[model samples]
Target: MFQDLDATLKALLDDAAGPAELQAADVSFDTPDKDYKPAQATVNLFLHEVTENRTLRDEARVMERVGDGYTSRMPPLRVDCTYLTTAWSAQAGALKAAEEHHLLGLALRWLSRFPIVDDRFLRGSLKNPPQLYPLPTVVAQTQEGRSNGEFWSALGIAPRPAFSVTVTLTVEPFDQVEDLPQVESIQITSTSIPDPTLAGRVLDHALTPVPAVVVTVVETGAQTTSARDGTFIVPGLGFGVYTLSVQAPAKPVEQVTVTYAADHQTHTVVLSGP
Candidate 1:
């Protein structure tokens, strides 16, 4: 990693217009003493992110360290540069031969403290070394409580909240996405019985269905109503058993069948929320 960083730094230094002497060094973290291992915890970096106009004032503390530590500090980060910062994790137990096996993973963060717009450092002057973004938040998802079987168990249920995905993109303005029209339908799912008593307040997990809720009868291709409280009544039906499905945005699909009674068919299915 040092070799790669050295080569990249050299490449950028030669391309610079000015004749400024640039030096590179590595910053390390200590645990009371240098020999102790920092296992499975917040690796703090008490680093600075200085820019031309403004700077991130807050100081962050971190534990883990990666080989490619300071790529965004110099080089192509000159001015008006736009790039993505990626993070990696390493197993901290053993390097060569003997060590205890531990699930201790460490976080690696690459930040762009200075958001380059043009040939200009939006945060700092292009003349000096750039400061990477102050807070490179890594989502710490440890398998602390849940077992491996829980993940596998999700598959057994017909339509259980199985998996989640998150995608992040840096854009000039976030509202630009709201303007786009719905050529394709996006489904957000939630349970019909949102609250037993509370009227307005919704649990943090459930989403208030926007546009409308989509209820589809698989065999007949029939669609129905979307009430203010998000309920649809299916009527004029003979004695039949069918699977009813409901879904919404960024939510799990829910399916439960009901045998319509001759008098009244009132059935409710619970979607495991959040």
Candidate 2:
């Protein structure tokens, strides 16, 4: 009979995590890939965040086609939904939650669904682990009770559209980093957004040692330092206030707070040190 989990034992399980949002079910990318080979055209599925008339987020696309007719005519569907987390679940497996949070972002880079749809999450049970095949996926969402006869119709699918089966993931890969070695006892988690302002050479540049710059998420005050490679990953942040700060001796500490619908939480934070 086991009651409380042993700290030593728990850390041993690399692929296991507890109290995570179970956002393990995020998406399955399929759009319009090349022809499906001998069969015909390839099939692609992409996850998209619905906007007024177009996909506002980094709507990805996976493609699978066969000739002009054959092959699997049906294309994989992209899912872009929200996971409403209270304080409880959000507290568990911080690093994992952070990974899942950023992975959910589709606001930047425009992920290529073609190479990742089949690797998405598709499962009949939410309790069990998810598959690694289907690229796009979803999380085991916790929804409040809904009213009867109240269907969740994509209000914008104008032209009087119909409804059908939307292939969802059995589990979403919200955060796989939870199983990493660096984050064992103390959970390390974060959130993300795509910072488009980081495009030009000015905003993003590499620098050497001298108080390595830290990528501080403008909102959560989360911190991740840059490596010798001048790389840092602050993944899975959400919408709200945030700042990225850089520190260098003999030079003024640089900090910038950003507020944009981040396409992806993982952005290359660069600083030109003095």
Candidate 3:
């Protein structure tokens, strides 16, 4: 992947230089140290750093349907590749500085015009397999936590006029993709629920309506109290036979058997004693 990026950068620079005098200058990726030297005018783009672009990081997985199954894979990793761009001229004295400065200026101008590396300039794997994402370019930007003076000093060379270029690229995290079988059919089932209710009244042996009596269904343990009108209601019961237990103040409990039906009707329970 790094090699592909190098080739792509070289191609872009070549296009930028076009058929002008700068076209004859060699584009090198070699480390520029004290011992480094070029025979003619050259543009040195040293790949100085590579780091993941966390802001562009994606954790989602991509899925595609193929034949009878679906293939899924993690999203590609995005990384920023930083390059230290410097110009070199074989000429000496003030002429050398002038030519180097001119070359650097032209390179910077051309690179700045492009926010993304054009697809036509891509080479090698970047072109053959085709890129999934656009290559975003950042020209002449200050690198975080990097010092140009220290970089030159570490290389045992004097500080020179240079700029940095960063390009964002995507890398596939894995080659293997998971395959899932396609679902052929779906089934759904539903059931009808019955909400039957029981309503009744309580009375004493004298055939007078009795209030404040507790009415309970012995089978389901459902209970309700008779209202001031001596009527009580119990909802959410299914169609079946249920035993009603009626009890009033200072009276014996009375048991009445009744059948609950879809067509509801009030039943009367008469206590044996007053």
User: Which one wins on lDDT?
Assistant: 3
Residue by residue across 1-274, what tens digits does model 1's lDDT show?
2222223323332333422221121222221122333342212221112222112232232222334231111111111111111111134434311111111111111111112222231222222233333212223222268443543343242221111111111112112221222233343433233222101111123344333445556556665634555556654445577766666446666666666554424554444565
In candidate 1, how many Å is residue 212 off? 2.3
Question: Residue 168 lDDT in model 1?
Answer: 19
lDDT of 2 by residue, 178-269 (tens): 22122123323344333332311113343233335555555566676655545555545545556777654345667765553455333433
Residue 21 shift from truth in candidate 3, angstroms? 2.8
Write the number of the candidate with greater TM-score, choosing between 1 and 2: 1
Candidate 1 wrong stretches, greater than 4 Å: 1-211
> What are the lDDT figures for the candidates, one per model?
0.31, 0.32, 0.84
User: How many backbone clashes does every candidate have?
Assistant: 19, 85, 0
Rank the models by TM-score, top first.
3, 1, 2
Q: For model 2, how many clashes?
A: 85
lDDT value for model 1: 0.31
Winner by lDDT between candidate 2 and candidate 1: 2
TM for every model, in the order presented, reads 0.23, 0.22, 0.66
* Top TM-score model: 3
Off by over 4 Å in 3: 16-19, 183-274
